[model samples]
Target: MGNTYRRVLLKLSGEALMGDLSYGIDPAVVDAICAEIKDVVNTGVEVAVVVGGGNIFRGIKGAAAGMDRATADYIGMIATVMNAMTLQDSLERKGVQTRVLTAIEMQEVAEPYIRRRAIRHLEKGRVVIFGAGSGNPFFTTDTTAALRAAEISAEVVFKATKVDGIYDADPKVNPDARRFQTLTYSYALEKDLRVMDGTAIALCKDNNIPIMVFNLAVEGNIRRALMGEPIGTLVGGSCGIS
Candidate 1:
């Protein structure tokens, strides 16, 4: 099937890379995700990724425990680069061209992030994995995903999470919590659904970028989402019934 999006940005948390492990990346899980990504790229859809660092270290948690916020965040940023490199290795092993661009300069390891260069790589059908969380301490990877999506003119942002979609309440805790197939940015923010944090959601809202939240654990979901399958909650613009 043809993809509905020409270019897309995928947001993945570091915890997602952990799979069922307690911490750190699980090679098997990264391989599976990369395989899915390779499949989408073969279909001629440009893909960019923004991965988080919660599994290795969370800056916020460190700060809460008395570490300097900026220092902790910088360390967190480095952790993201580690994740990006791992993803790049996996994708390349699958015979897919991939680039690891870091917000912070890492000449020996990866190329520094240049907006036009990143776009050019995407245009050439190479997967670009953006690491280091915007080169700033205060930003989250979610915000980076939104910012990069806008900068790259991605057609949509796919937020691959553990949950299938956004729920009225914690689906794990509330068996009856409802899932909205579609949601307006205002509603998601007003209700604080934590879809991608306030900054990320607002960035998407201002740019009119749609976000599709789906379960990454479900095999073939990335391809399904690209096909415009209604398997997740879409957030952006207006939804008549949501």
Candidate 2:
């Protein structure tokens, strides 16, 4: 039928923008993702995106290397801002109006995050990309996605990752691991599936927001997910594992 969601929050890992590169963004990959988003926007679905910065710098890894944990996390947040700007540029090139709002203040580059302003932009049919990971230490972009989704009253969170779906175990390590078509939020949390950080999952669970975890590398997957094509794992529906 028509699109399955009216407004949705998309969570994109920085590594997904890297393509086959070892580090940094791949222009081609960004363009492809932007094109997919543009198509979805044309369908009248309001879109907001939260991007991670693992490709450029990972706060946890930095902290492990002896850097100040909070400082490392702040750097990571800045990295996410870079990613957000790149996404904005790509989306705009494709004729989709885009706005970048950062949790951290960086007026020279982007507007500081304002909940009302972001919601207004979405209402006006503009793609709003949230950057800077909530402007706090130790919080993940996934959590930011859940928080923003709740703030904007989004129907679902689209978590675009490298894997196609969530499996009982790491699919790469266990070939026999089964992928669940649907899962309860409690199961996901109890199993520690890492569909998202526990905080993010709990936030979504509390808000009763569904999360669709799908492969970002596959072209048209975003559109497929929006159309409710069952392309990946679905979390927080029916209150049980399936």
The deviation in Å at residue 203 for candidate 2 is: 0.4
lDDT of 1 by residue, 57-164 (tens): 999999999999999999999999999999999999999999999999999999999999999999999999999999999899999999999999998999999999
Which residue pairs collide in model 2, if any? none
Instruction: Show how many residue pairs clash in every candidate, following the order shown.
Output: 0, 0
Please list the residue runs of candidate 1 whose C-alpha ends up more than 4 Å from where it truly belongs after superposition: none
lDDT of each: 0.94, 0.94
lDDT measured at residue 120 in model 1 versus the true structure, 0 to 100:
96
Candidate 2 residue-wise lDDT, 1-242, digit = tens: 69889999999999999999999999999999999999999999999999999989999999999999999999999999999999999999989999999999999999999999999999999999999998999898899999999999999999998899999999999999998889999999998999999999999999999999999888899989987799899998564687
- Can you tell me which runs of candidate 2 are displaced by over 4 Å? none
